[model samples]
Every structure is written in structure tokens, then in C-alpha cells.
Target: MTPLDSSWLAARPLPQPDGDIDKNSRGRVLVAGGSETVPAALRLTGEAAFRAGAGKVQLATVERAALALGLTMPEAATFPLPANDAGELGAAAGSVLAGYLDRCDTLVLGPGMGAEAAATAILSAVIGEPRKGLSLVIDAAALGACADMPNAVRAHEGRVVLTPHPGEMAQLMQRDKSRPEDDPEALACEAAERFGATVLLKGAQTWIACPNQPVLRFAGGGPGLATGGSGDVLAGIIGGLLSRGTPPRTAAAWGVWLHGEAGRRCAEQIGQLGFLGRELLPHIPRLMASQR
Candidate 1:
């Protein structure tokens, strides 16, 4: 496994804006559904996207969470879609989402979403139908939806990136709990090839793999990254970079490194164990700015 470090960043530097460009010209990101109860997950993601250089950020969530998110994050435009009694996004919202698909450069699916039956239907509809110019970052409860069909995300055909922890990865592969594919490098590569999407298997040491490319390993987040919702931030950061027009593989790799750096910095400031996932938000652009 190769380390993702400054040398790697130097070798494959991030893209820089050329000339006069408006915020719209830079990038626009759409975050689709997290749990109605904890829209913070999706909110964290959209904020991270903005920090990662996305010019515009939008959120499409359930009715209740929709209003809260709009009030909390004024920078993003929020849409409230139909929700079930359990407060999860419903299948009926698919048509509403289709109308916004063309407007975003990248889509972040499944953050705080609880694995409700409706979630699977929504995921199936969205992931089953891939968009030509859109990039997808699939994480959290959405991974459960992927578990139902081994090849459903394959429809994305290299345009999607799946960020899953070990448990979720097992579900995606339908592997036994023993986790025969627990080795980050092998699991990341295998998932990428089998699902036809870039894979970032999150762990103490994260690994990213894309088809036909060597595995990229990043090893430096402290225990701080162990906190809940961190994966949401990671997904958002990666999605944001993708929205900025970074290629899938590059965006995943860069996102992993930037995420780790942000975690380490946050840990250093607040002590290793007490930092919140939202704490990582403020450090993201600072880390990304230094990298660029």
C-alpha cells in the first residue's frame, strides 16, 4: 500500500482555476437525504463541500429536517421532499429529485439516514439510474441499500465513490462477519472492481482503490476520527472535490488525505478523544488551502 502524502499531492496536484470564473463556474453540489431526525449529518457534508471548494451547496431532505437545515446553514438552498411517518425519505420523492439532478455537479447520498424500507427504494431508484455527467458519493445507510443488489451501484459505472466502514463494507460484499476481506487494501480494490465504483474503505488507516489503478493508503487520523458522523464529513469532502470537477479517483484520494489531516488537527486542538465530527468542519478549508 502506498502512502498518500505531500509527495503524492505534489505528483498529482489539485486543479487550479485558470481565469475569470464565477462561483457557478467553479462547482455546485447537491446532498440528497440523511435522517430527518439528524439532518446534521447531511448538513456537515454540505458545509464540508463548501470548505472543499464547492461554489454552491444544496440539500434535499425530508420536510422537517429541510426547514431546520435551511435555518442552520443559510448558505445552502434546501428542498423539503415527502417523508414517511418514520421520518425517512420516501420513494415518492424520486421524481422531485430527478428534476434537480442536472443542476448539481456531484451528489452525496445517505449520511444520517436510518436504514428504512423507503431508503432502499430511494437508493435503488437513484443508483439504479446513473447520470452521465454527475458524480456520486454514497455513504452510511445508503450502503445498506447497496447490499440488496451487489451490482446496483455498478450501474454508476465508474462515476460513483462508495465510502463505507468495515461493517458496511461486509454488507456490500455480503461477506460473513468474520470479514475475510477486512484488509483495507484488498477490500478497497475488490469493492471498486466488483461494484464499478471507486472505493474508500474507512478505518484507522483508510484505503482508496479505483479500477486499473494501484491502491492509495492514508494512515494518520488519531482516535478523533473514530467519532460518529466523521464518515459523513469524509463523504461530503470527497463529494465536494468531485463537484469542483476533480475526477473520481483523484477526488477520493485527495479527500482521504484532507480528511485525515483535518482530524489530526482537530484532535491536536481539543485532545484526541473529545472532538466532535462537526469540529472537523472548520479545519477542512484550512487544510485544503495549505495543500493547494
Candidate 2:
């Protein structure tokens, strides 16, 4: 494993144009996730996607949380799904969500989604579908749910990007729990090849690998990013880039780099010790400009 250093930071690709036009031309992103306890995940992701230049962001989540998110971010569109008695999305909502899938340029899954029969069923339907125009970014809890679905991975015709932390990667690969400091790149590369999808394994030196290409490592992120909701923000950024028509590999690469850079910038302002994940969101546009 290569240690994160200046050389690794220099390897990241510079930022490119935000997109060809204004918000309408940027592309649409559909963010699906959020259980009762973690209602904030979907909102955080939608905000991050918008900050990353997505033209429009639609969120499909449990009904109760949907109202709050809609009111908070009126720019975002919300679709409330029927929830079970426990206030979590139920299996029956999958068919209802299928209609909206066709409208999005990219799909972002697993931010704050809780484990329940209903959420799993919805995820299965989304993953099992054979949509060609949309891109998919799978992260967090969704990673664990779909890790065993080899057929689902094989069947996906759209661009698929998997973002996993060390523990999540181990779960996906069925390996022992290993720290990101412990050869994460090799393990990530293996998982990417096995699933035939691009993998972004998050850690000190984030590793990005595709089925046949050499693994690319990003080293600029700071320890300030070691907080909850950080991965959710990264997933949203990946979704935003995908919606803008960037390829999975390029989007993952740039998203990871920009996320880390934004965290670093936020740390400088607020100091790393107490910086929150949401605090980093506002800095993304400035970070993008710096990269350009």
C-alpha cells in the first residue's frame, strides 16, 4: 500500500467544466435512502449532489422525512414512499419507485437507509433492473445488501460505481475485517474485478480501481474527513458527476479528490477537531474552483 503523500496528491486529475449549461443542463440525480432514525442522510446527500453541480435532485424517502426535506431544500423534488408500521420503507414501495427511475440520469443508493424488508426489496428491484441510460452509485448500507448479489452486479448494464470503506469492502469481498491502512488498494482492486464494476475504497489514501485499469490512489484528504456522513456526501458527489454524463471511473476519481480537498479546506477554516460533515458541503464549490 502506498502511503498518502504529496506525490499521491499530485496524481489527481484537475477539475473540469461544471457542465455545458445552467442547472437545467447539469443533469438529474435521484437519491434514495433514509430510515426513521437516519432521516438526515437523504437530505445531506441531496444537498451535496446539488452542491456538486447536479441540475436537479430528486429524493425518494420515507414519507415523514420527505416533508421536512422538501421544506428545507425546496429546490429538491421529493417523492414520499409508503412506509411500514415502523416508519421505514416497505417492500411494496418498489413498484411505485420504478416509474421515477426512468426520469433520473443517475441513481444514488444507501445513504442512511436502514435495514428492513421493505428497503431491501426496493433496493433489489432497483439493482435488478436493466436500465442503460442511468448511472448507479452504491454506498454504505446498500453495499452490504447487494454485496452477495453477483447476478445483480452482472446484470447491470448502466455504469456502476461501488464506494466502500474498509469494513464494507471486507463484507462485500467476504474477507476478514481489515483496516484501510492494511493494503486497501489490493483488496479494492480484487473486489472491482470480481464484480466487474468500478470500486472506490475510502481511507487515508483512497483507492479507485476498474476491472482492467491500474488502481488510482488519491492522497490529499485529511483526517478531518473521519466523521459520520462523509461517505454519504461523497456518494452524492459521484451521483452528481454521473448525472452530468461523466464516466464512472472519471466521476469516482474526481469526486473522491474533490471530497477530500473540500474536507481539507473546511478543516483549515473550522479546525479538524470539531468540523462536521455538513460543514464541508458548502466548501465544495470553492474547492472545485480551486482545482480548476
Candidate 3:
């Protein structure tokens, strides 16, 4: 595993575009998640992507949240898909998503997506199709969708990233004999190799790994990051960076640092227990400016 020293963090840079450039010149991000039950999940994810520096961000969710989501976020557009009888997205969403997948530089999947057959079908359809030059950040229920199909995203190689917490990690690697509880670093590495993508095993110390790349771990975040929507924020951060032309490894490295650092700051400001998930959004710009 790599230490991810300060020198490396300072030296390895992100894209720096001119002030007059449009959103596309900076990066385009599309977040696809949310069902009838939890519209806020997709909205929060999209907000984090924008705060993290994606110039243009679009969010796709079930029809139940379309009008509300669009009204809440004017800077980013929202598209609504047909919902199934279960009040969740289904495989039919893949048809509408095809056009979106073609347009965005990166896609963030799974937030507020319940573990249901509909979610599984929707994710499976999206995974079965091949993508070119597009990056994917899989989180939440999408991890479960592809759990049984280890090769679901393997064809995409380094273009994909899977963010899973301990429980989610167990779900994702259910068929494997190794217990993720024993060694997170090994689990991350093996999962990355298995999926042919980057894997971030989230915890107090997030372990990031990809095939042929040195493992990077960040142990900065406090218990403040244990909140519900915090992982959604993380998925957005990494997805946002990937949209802006950052490689999966570098993006994961910086994303984890930014997230952990923000959580650390949040904990300090609010006595370790009062910070809300939305509070993390404002901290992102501060961190970016300091890094710049």
C-alpha cells in the first residue's frame, strides 16, 4: 500500500480551466439514482458533484421526484424516468438512460436506491451495456445489483469505481471466501481486480485500490462521517472528479482526502455530533481553494 504522502497530494494536480470556459470545458457529470421514496438522495448527490467542481451536473431519477428535484436545483437539469409498480426504478429505465450515458463524461449510480428487484434490474441493464471513455462510480444499492455478477463492470476496466462500506462490501463480495471484516486493504485490492475497476472500501480509514496501482488509504475522517448521507457525498465527490478528466486512482485519492478532511473539520466545528450532511457541501469549496 502507498502512503499517499503530502508531497504526492500537492504534486499530483487536477484540471485547471480558464475562467471564461463553459461547464462542458470543465466537466459534465450525471447522477442516476433515487426512487419514489427518497428523492433527496439524488438531489444531495448532485449538489455535492457541483460543489466539488463539476461545471455541469445533471440528475436522473424516477418521476416522483422530477418536478421537485428540478425546482430545487436550477443550475443542474433533472430528468425523470418511468417508475415501476414497486415505486422504484426498473430495467426499463435503461432505455431512457442510454441517451444520458452517451452525453455525460461520468455517471454516479446508486443513492437512495432501495434493495429491491426493480433496482437490481435497472442496474443490471445499465451494466450489461458497454461504455466507452465514460467513467462510472457505483454506490449504495447499485453495489448489491452487481454483487452476484462480478464481471458486470469488468469489461469497463479502469473506467469504473465501486464505493462500498463494510455491509455493502459484504454484499458485493458475498460469493468470495475472504471476509472483508478481516482485512479491508486486501478486500479492496481483490475487489478492484475482480471488477477491473477502482474500489474504495469505506471506513474510518478508507482503502482505495485498482489493479496494478498502489493502494491508497486515508484515515482522516472522524465519526462525523458515519452519518447517513455522507457516503452519498463521497460518491458525488469522486464522480465529480472523474467527470473533470481525473483518472480513477487520482480522483479516488483526492476525493477520499477531501471527504475525510471535510468530515474532520465538520466534527471539530459541531462538537463531533451535530454536523449535517448538507453542511459538508460548503466545506468542499474551501478545501478546493486551499488546495489551489
Models 1 onward score TM values of 0.95, 0.89, 0.94
Kindly report which residue stretches of model 3 are placed more than 4 angstroms away from their true locations once superposed. 175-178
Q: For candidate 3, what is the total of clashing residue pairs?
A: 0
Choose 1 or 2, whichever is better by lDDT: 1
Model 1, position 136: C-alpha lDDT score: 91
List candidate 2 segments past 4 Å from native.
1-24, 117-119, 179-181
* CA displacement after TM-score superposition, residue 273 of candidate 2 (Å): 1.5
lDDT of the candidates, in the order given: 0.83, 0.80, 0.84
215 Cα displacement, candidate 3 (Å): 1.0
Write candidate 2's Cα lDDT for 84-164 as tens digits. 877777777677777789889899987887666364577687877768887899887778766678668767743889998
lDDT at residue 94 of model 2 (Cα atoms): 76
Tens digits of per-residue lDDT, candidate 1, 1-292, equal 6788878877777777668987877888999886667776778888889888898999998887888888999999999878888888888876777678888989888887886727677777676677888889988878867776657777777889989888888888888755724466887788888888898888888888888988888888877889888888888899889988888989998898888888888878889888888888888877777866
Higher TM-score: candidate 1 or 2? 1
**How much is 76 displaced in model 3, in angstroms?**
1.2
**Cα TM-score of candidate 2:** 0.89
Per-residue error (Å), model 3, residue 228: 1.4
**For candidate 1, which ten residues in a row score worst on lDDT?**
176-185
User: What TM-score does candidate 1 reach?
Assistant: 0.95
